[model samples]
Structure formats: C-alpha cells, structure tokens
Target: MTDEAALNALREAARLSPENLPLRRHLADQLLASGNLSQAETEYQAALGLSPGDHGIAIGLAEALVRQGKNEAALTALDPLLAMPEHPVRAGVLAAQAMLPVNRMAAAHWYRYSVARDPSQADPELAHRLGIGQPSAPPPSSTSPSPIPSGPAGLPAQPPSPAPAAPTQQPSPAPAQQPSLIPTAHSPSVVPAPHAQPQAAGGPYGSADVEPTAEVEHSPVTFADVAGMDTVKEALRMKLLLPTQQPELFAAYGKRAGGGVLLYGPPGAGKTHLARAAAGELGAAFVNVGLADILDMWTGSSERNLRATFAMARRNRPCVLFFDEVDALAARRSDMRQAHSRQIVNQFLAELDGVDEHANEGVLVLAATNAPWYIDAAFRRPGRFDQMVFVPPPDTVARAAMLSLMCRDKPQAKMDFDKVARATEGFVGADLKGLVDRAVEAKLHESIRAGRPIPLATGDLMTAAKTMRPTAVREWLGTARNYVLHANESGAWDELLPWLRDLR
Candidate 1:
C-alpha cells in the first residue's frame, strides 16, 4: 500500500481500538516519522499513561521529547525509568547526550559512567564531539573496573580518591602515587585550591599551558549567520572586516588590520557568539580563552601562561583571541586582595601593551564581560580595548529574526513572528530561545489533550512570553544604571547612557 493509505489505516485502527496499546504506539511512531511531533507527543504520552512502568514506552516518549528539541523535558520523562536498574544504560546514554551541550565535561563523566556499566554501549562520537577522547596509548590490563568518580556540576574537580583495594589481587604500588603528584589540571581540579593557594596552574589537560594544547578552531559562522544587530555588524565591519578588505585604504591612514574591542553587555546577549562571528567574517582562527585556562595557583605561571596565549595568537596572525568573562581575570587590581590577582592584571596590561607597546598588530583582542565596570582601566588605553561595544538585548528586528532562526529546524506552525517579537521587547537571543521552548512545551500539552497535531501558534508563544522575563538585561541594567549615573568619570560609559536612558 501507498504511504498515505498506511497512515490512514493506522489512524483508523488506533481510533477504532482505543484500548489497544500497540496500535496507539504504532500510530505515535508513524506520526513521529512524518514530523507530526505534536500528535506524536500525544500518542506517546497516552501510551505512557496507560502503561506507566513500561520502559520501552517511556523511552519512546523521551525520544519524542528529544526529537522536538525538549531535551530538559526528555530528562524529566526519563527520570522515573532511570531509577529502575533493569536497563539504565539507555537512560544513562540519553542523559549523557542531553548534557553534552550544557555541560560537556560532566557529559564525559556520564559517558564514562554508562561505558563502565557496559563498555559496548560507549559512543566515540560523543567523546569526539566533546573533545575528550582516549589517549593514544592503550590502558594497562586490570581485573577490576574503576568506579566513575562523581563531581559537582559544570567542571568536575574531584579530590583525589584513594584506589579501592581489590581483594582478589594485590594493588600496584606506583599507580597510587600518580594522583597526588599530578596537580589535576584538566581533570576537574578546575575549582581553585581552597583559599586560592599558589599551586602550579596548568592547561585543562593537567599539563602546563606554556606550549598550550592545540585547540585552534576555524569558525564557519560569519556575521551573515548572526541575526539582527545591524549596528553591531556595521561597527565590526569598520573596526575590523573593512580594514582587512581594504588594507591599502586603511594603511594610507596609518591604520592596522587589527585592534581591540570590548563587548560589554548583559550575560546571554550573544557577546561570545558575536566574537566567533567576527572571527568567521574575518576568516581568522578563533582561540577562546577562559578563566580556567589562564588562572594558575603558581605565582608566575599565570603571567607566563597569559603571555604564551598572546604569543600564540600573534604567531597565528589574524587570530581572534576571544576572552570570555574578562572581568573575572582582568578585574580592578585595587579591589583584588591576592597578590597573584594583581600580578595577573599587570601581566594582562603588559601583554596588551606588548613589546615596546605594538605587539598586537594583526591579532584582534576581543574580551567580553557582563560587568564592564569591573574591568581594569589601564587596559582601556587607546591602542588597547578602546572600542567598547554595548551589546544590549535584541531590539525588535533581532527578536523576530532570532525567533525564525531558532525555530527553523523544528516543526513550527503558523507563528506570528512580528507579534512574538513585539511581545518580547527586552528579551535577548537566549531569552527568545527560552520563549520558543516554553511555547513548545505548552503546545505539546495541548496536543496531548487534543489527541492531534496542534502547530505552535502565536497565542502559545505570547502566553509563554507573558510569564517570562529577560534574564540578564534587567539585572545588568539595574547594576549598569548606577555606573551610568555615578561613574561616568572618563565618559567610558558614555555610549551606555543613551541605551540606559531609553529604558527609562
């Protein structure tokens, strides 16, 4: 029979045999295959409600949630099944997959957990995606399996656990000494030593960052891929892209191909992504620097590490050194109590100053911080990060475009983009994403009740928007308004005043 005929027959069978669980599940599977997520979710929910303890049904429902991009919701659905010890490998695998984007290091731990339970269930792709693959050398044969050491969220910084003695065999003497000797750099000893002691800081891989790990990424995402922000794009074009495009024109005016830009905004305002886009548009290598990579407990290593990063960026030439959470590392030295913090700040300024104050010629130094007010003043000197770009929440145009971009892959119904945009005034790109996810959740419920596909509509989005608020913008503005009012000393916050005033 043709595909249409089969679907019709299944629907008829499901409707006629409302009591038949297999038919309902079959119908749900068919709907899922046809991209009818709303109805598929309904069928799965119904099947699950009928047979609450059925792991297969629960897995189906979780898979449906995942396919609809409700990963968190899928976790909620899988939680009950996870408690059962029967076939938790499936739940563990799915949870690990879901956690990858949110917390990659933690996901690696989960993958290890699942793999330990059943080595055959391991997924190399997941590890490869997270950049946490096995070392080239093979592991030494051991009769006993190692327990997966659990840690807190985000970065796993487990304190050294003494090896459990294997009753069946004598423990190797040498392997016991390895954990204490190694400073546990990349292995989640990420949280600094208590009281922030002066231990040797190293790269994420538990090795010195002096030579640094080879982690240069070529971003394919350009300014064109970024939604909205015409003003931001234009400023970047003039500051970086256009100069590179018309080198002679810039050279005639004694302008170099690169300089520095400080993207100061509320958190989740896409500062980091915009940095990537800038690198992509410039066709340069992107080297993302975080606090973990730079801060070492050892006194001079932090400075050395900081210099090495700049040196690497310079050698790469035409590289975008994007520093996330710049305020944390480059915070005002006076506010800092630790000598190391102050020294790191000094090193940061010196590196920005470079050899005889002209090192960062071809390198673009872009640092993003939610609290630009906390950034050191010396770093803002003309040749340094003079171009402070104020990235506010998405304006109307951006919100609309962001809505379209975020929901492009998902099966969306007739969504009024303009209406949604209007409803979400102060919402940033991430907030807009939340709005859509909330709407998807609401729509999923409605479909479950109606027992049919109900496309995501404007009303559903608007309803979700009414209950939601922009996360960082309101809070950031609350703090930023004070700076605008009191600390406009050098008029560094001059650009922020207009945007702040508009809110009032």
Candidate 2:
C-alpha cells in the first residue's frame, strides 16, 4: 500500500478506537518517521493521554517536538521521563539530541550523561561535533587552561559548526532522575491484535515477545440484553451499579469505588450474564477468567498466575474480572487435601486483601459459583465477596420475558405468556430458551407438512414445555439444601434458606 493509504488507514482506526493507546502510538511513530512533526505531536499527545506514564511514548513526543525545532518544548516534554530512575537511555539520548541544534553546551552535558548510561546508542557523529570522544573517566578540573585537545594549527580539530538561530528562550538540562514504578499501560477498552498468549520458563505469563500488560476483554451485553431475573437485576443495581454511578456519596461514608460481588446459584442460571451486564452498564472493561487462565500443571505456578492476573486486573482499573466456577480455585482450604491447593487459596486472599505491593484498588472482582459452600470462609470477609447474590431460576415474569424476547422475530401469534410461564415454573433462563426452540421446531415441522407457513401459538409453546423433563433446578437445589442446613453459620446461606423453605 502507498504511504498515504497506510497513513489514512491508521488515522481512521485511531479515530474509531480513540482509547486505543497502542494504535495511536503506532500511528504517531509512523507520522514522526515520515517527518509529519505536527500531526505526530498531536497523535503522541493523544496516546500520552491514554497512557500518561508511558516513557516510550513520552520520548517519542519529545523527538517530534525536537524535529520541529521546538527544543525548549522538547525538554519540557521529556522532563517526567528523564526523572524516572533506571533512567531510560533512549530518553536521555533523545534529550541530548533534541538540544543539539541550539544549546550545544547543555547538549554536551546530556550527551556525556547519555553515553555514561548507554555507550552503544550515543550518536558518534553528533559527539564528534561537540569535540567529545568515547566515554572515559571524569575529565580534568574545568580550571585547566586547555580543556580540549588542540590540532597542529593551535585550534580544536574540526571546529564544531554554529547552531541555527536560537529561539528567545534558553533550553534547560533534563530533570533530575527519580524512581518510577510505572507498569505497562494498556487501555482496558482496547483489544490487542490477535497474537499468541506467550508464556516464559521462569516468569509468570511471560515470554520475550510479551511484556506485562493489562488484559481487557469486551462484552456487548447489558442489563437490557439479560433475558430476565428482575430480582437479580435490582440486587445488582443496589450493590454494584449504584455505588459506581454515585461513588462520592458512598465515599462520604468511607466506601471504596469497587469491591467483590459473589453471584451463586444453579448451573446455567445466567450468573455470567449478570456479570457481563454489570460491566456493560458501568461502561467499564470486562475480563472473564477460568481455570485455564490461571491453573498450571507445574508446582507453585498457580499462585504466581493468580498474582499476575490480579496485577493485570488492577492495571485495567475499573475492570470487571469475572471468574466462572470460582469455587474450584477458592475452595475451602480445610477441605483441600493437597498443600498446593491450600497455597493457591492463600494467594487469592492476599490479592483480595491488597497485600504487599498489589491490590484490587479499582478492579471489581465478580466470581460465580454453583458451590459457594466450597469457597474458603476467609474469602467472605468484609472487603472480599462481601455481598452474595443468589441467582434463582427464572420466575414467572422472567419466563414470559425470555419467551417473548426469543420469539420476537419469529412468526408468533398473540400468545398467552402467563399460561406458558406458569407451566414452566422452576425453569432457568437456559431452560426457557430451550422451550422456545422446541416450539419453533414444532412450527417448522407443521410448515413443512402443509407446504405453507404456521405461526407459533400459546398451545405450541405449552406443549413443548410439557414435553421437557424436570428442570435442572431440581438437581442443583438437592445439593444446595444440604449446605444451608448443615453450614448455616454467619447467615451466609440465609437467603438460600427462604428459597429452600419455599421449595419445601
């Protein structure tokens, strides 16, 4: 493709996904390479907004300013990055080079400093112009009569050329270096281009090709997309949704922005769907994790993976980290027969507690489990899994809603939703969907038989519901009942108690 075409394509992509830091940075790099200094500066500034602490992008912006002959502006742009310890040699080199056109003396100081940090990258050609040689020990005191070597002509050999017209303002040296703990900044709204999830030998989730970056997976589902379960919806609105929308009100009473909300119920009860809806409603990024994302076959790796996942989650602040079947990972330590399993539980607690260096500061952790009884009791402490919301089978209202939604596009007559909903009591969202499919199948067969069309009616749906066997809720409730009775401490199972009593 032509350069113009590539530039246009990148610009369009950056426009479409304005929060995409990597895409914007890549576009900025391309523009700078093409000598489009002004546009490159704008793109770099944008990328910097998305990732304020990114030194590489900061240096890139400085370079663009330097290319435009704004040496003083370049120095200001490079200030924050230069202040960072393990001082980036690239930033220093760029700072030195950006100053070369006007402030040769200041440029010489930075040049010497850059070469001290990275001998390989210092531009030899530029160093030659400043009357400097390769990096060596400290030079003699400035009081010496002859600071630099003189040629046979009694003058410095190859006298440095004068810089172009200097701007009114003088350039200052790079800022003093300070320590920075900036991690890789990846915008949670941006889905990285498809690539392998490379792993390393010693590090947790690492490889030469991969840097420790944030993980953000998007979900299109919102509360409107969720089929039914108004009870569950209102519970979420009160627990997760309201606080996020009005954080200041909650903070007035010492409440933090995000916390853990446990969604537990029978299998296929739309627990995962509820989590996705919460993410969508918040307009926050979503990351759905499973055993495959954390568990490793090797020893001591599981805990590291847990730490790494939490770290990644925190980086994608305001992120919803949904864990399906979380009981398998956070199972009661007393019940765990193996030491490794127990250790993993401890690691989870540490992450939840914001131990040592890591914390779930802005991350909203949502874990769903069929066996909430299996999760370690420690996980239910104040800050972690504080609110447990039971996602029961679809009620009459939910059943009717699910049926109407499923059949909205199909040829359905004025249907008696109440009749079908009453018939399919104890059914979950998945089961309700199956009933609709069965009804559609019947309509399809009748159409084929008569060689004409037949719209779905209430009789068609009720017949399909009757044909279906006992709902899966029966199987799940049988197991859950035993827990609510035997382990009723802390009233964690109090909500389940009422439901169990109703079933009886």
* Each candidate's clash count: 5, 2
Among all windows of 10 consecutive residues in model 2, the one with the lowest summed lDDT is 180-189
TM-score of 1: 0.58
Candidates' lDDT values, in order? 0.71, 0.71
- Residue 199, candidate 1: Cα error in Å is 11
Q: Please write out the lDDT profile of model 1 over residues 1-504, one tens digit for every residue.
A: 987788889888888888799899888888888888888889989888788888777777777777777876776676555433233666666766766666566556555545555566667877688676532211234333332232442232332233455787654211110111112222232224322222222212224446643257899999877898778878778777888888999989988867888898888889988999999998998999877667654335566678778989988878888899998878887785444456678888888878964588778889999999888888888988888888878889888888888878766778789888998888888888888899888888888999987777778888999999877787788789999889888888887776776665
> Model 1 off-target regions past 4 Å?
1-209, 356-358, 444-454, 502-504
Q: Give TM per candidate.
A: 0.58, 0.57
Reference-based lDDT, residue 180, model 1: 13
Write one digit per residue (lDDT tens) for candidate 2, span 1-504: 999899999999999999988899999999999989999999999998998888889889988987788766776677555544345777777776766666565556556656655677778887898778766423222121212222222212222222232375333222221111111121111111232233343222222223333457777888987876777777667655677788889779876566788899998788998899888877878888877666543224456667778777777777888889998888887774444556678888888888633266568889999889888889989888888889988788888887887788998788999889999888888888888898888899999998988889999999999898656788788888888888787777888776777665
